[model samples]
Target: MIKVAGMLLLLDFQLLPPTASSEAAKLDSLFFFLVALCGTVATLIIIFILYFVVKYRRRTPDQLALSGRSYRTLELAWTLIPFAIFLFIFYWGAKLYFNLMTPPEDAIEINMVGRQWMWKVQHPEGQREINTLHVPLGRPVKLAIASQDVIHSFFVPAFRIHLDVVPGRYRTIWFKATETGTFHLFCSQYCGTQHSGMKGDVVVMEPEEYARWLNSGSEGSAASEGQKLFRQLSCNTCHTGDSTARAPFLGGLYGKQVNLQGGDTLLADDNYIRQSIVDPEARIVAGYKPIMPTFKGQVDEEQIMLLISFIRSLKEGREQIPPVSDPAGPQPSPVGDAIRQSETNANAGNQPRTNANSTDQE
Candidate 1:
């Protein structure tokens, strides 16, 4: 009895990490309720076993034991009670999971790439970091996570969030921190030799501080970098806004339903965009020829993410390419340079040459 009392008392202390997100509180509440219910059932079972053992002890050798006994009320009560408890737990857990999976529309977006031993994090506003992530305390933050080498999980014990980052695909997880503080971030999956070292810190700050930090960085925003890549790779040549172009216009493609070749429709989300870039032939849009070359080996994971960011930034009834402050910042590709040179030479050849006689006449 003393041990049981002690165990119940220990429950007062937090068995999990500190709750730092809104969902964490809900998760903890459900967890403790289940724990208490299980504990009560266990205690009663032990007590009944002990009581029967003592009461049924044989005092005389000739004492006869009862063959069987049945209590319909007790049997029904036990069965219905546990069944009801299980149903309640399932409902509570499912509600919490649904809330966790849905993100607010105004949530801040961030990109994360998990590699063998480190995390590469990027903000849509251009700030990039290795392993560390910073966000505002009260705003919802969505992380578009992908794995470069193998499977990795993004886990924060305080937030009670764990999501798998799979290679060749993008997965998103979102959380809003309720307090301003630093929390631990870990890759829960056993990735490789340095999986233990794949750890970082998630710093939740005031809104003002987060803004200042974002402005302090000099790196171009992810969308801008992606814009540069789009031009360098000559994507605009094919996916032009002109209706006669061989490829479909990408303007306002994100979040829209696209008809595929097989008479199926797919939402043009992040994963779909990534797959379209890396695996062009996988799903060809209806009325468009499958002429796009796959970028599987040509571009890395980070480049793919930049392209995705640029694509998502597009809006309906707007130019496909947003105006960049520094349009010529990125150097032209070798092929582009060669084509320009050829054009320049051809124009020079077409110009009338001033021979000696022509110069005298002039």
Candidate 2:
């Protein structure tokens, strides 16, 4: 029991506040106001109870009879005062919640995906990640998240923002990491057997460091070698063109309008596309089945970028030549005649010649 209590207490662990971003400041204000209001009310209630207990206590009296009486003024004051205090708290909390929910108009949008054990993140430039997230300071970052499997929660204690990631639904949560430092993340829900092991870090950096990180040939960069591997897997085969694929095409989809199956329209920008790839059922593409499988473990950030680039390159009238192993000529398929001929040559003279093999054995 003690161990469980300790774990619950550590769930929303918070460290010192970094610099004050807009969201962080608002959150701090809300927290402070709530703590003060509740503290004051609790103290007053305790004092009132103690005072009444002493004042009305029965004293030793041989011929006294006890009678109960109510003070009209005291009752009215207590009732009205507590009601007013609760109302104030409600109004204040609601205002802050509205501010947090309605993201700023100019906020930079990023797609966030949650799975059983990790987070799949995608940047506006098509970069992707598994368990790490990156964003620039002083800029509003919005996350559109969906779960690939069971229900999961996206929580960053430093930011004071959290939301549930449910399958077959789209949920949006935004936060601006004010200070440029690393913060811890938690699932916040009993997800699976590896729930405790499902942990990751959020790296917040300055604009310059973030930019350098993006261009520093790091493995998670949008244009790194992992993207090359992604292209090698040929994701464009079914995602683009009128290729009879079930899901929507990826051409010109980055900032274009998307029509979902349920008569709703959304921008087919970075966030939408990323979620669709990682959690296809979150928002179904119009006129298509949610048959697109999740690529959770098979793909990396760079590969996701390569896939995004390929998709982005498919904008109207832009035919992108896939960067596969080709030497200015047609590339044969793996099962084409060349492979078949090689296999036949390797077994050329190994077959038994009519009855000669039997006679030699005798």
Q: Note the Cα lDDT for every prediction shown.
A: 0.76, 0.61
Please give, for residues 1-362, the per-residue lDDT of candidate 1 as tens digits: 99978987887845468789988888898888888888998999999999999999888999999898899999999899889878988898999888888877666778999999999998765678888998888888888899999999999998999999999888888899998899999999999999999999999988777766765643555666777888778787787667787888787677789999989999998889899998999999999999999988888888888888777655443344423434554321111111112322222221122210110120
The regions of model 1 sitting more than 4 angstroms off are: 1-15, 55-68, 317-362
Error of 2 at 86 (Å): 2.8
Expressed as tens digits, the lDDT of each residue in 117-151 for candidate 2 is 88887663435667888888777777777677889
Q: How accurate is candidate 1 locally (lDDT)?
A: 0.76
Model 2 misplaced stretches (Cα beyond 4 Å): 1-21, 61-81, 124-130, 218-250, 253-315, 318-362
Give the 10-residue window scoring lowest on summed lDDT in candidate 2: 331-340
* Residue 178 in candidate 1, Cα distance off native in Å: 0.4
Model 2 lDDT, residue 171, Cα: 77
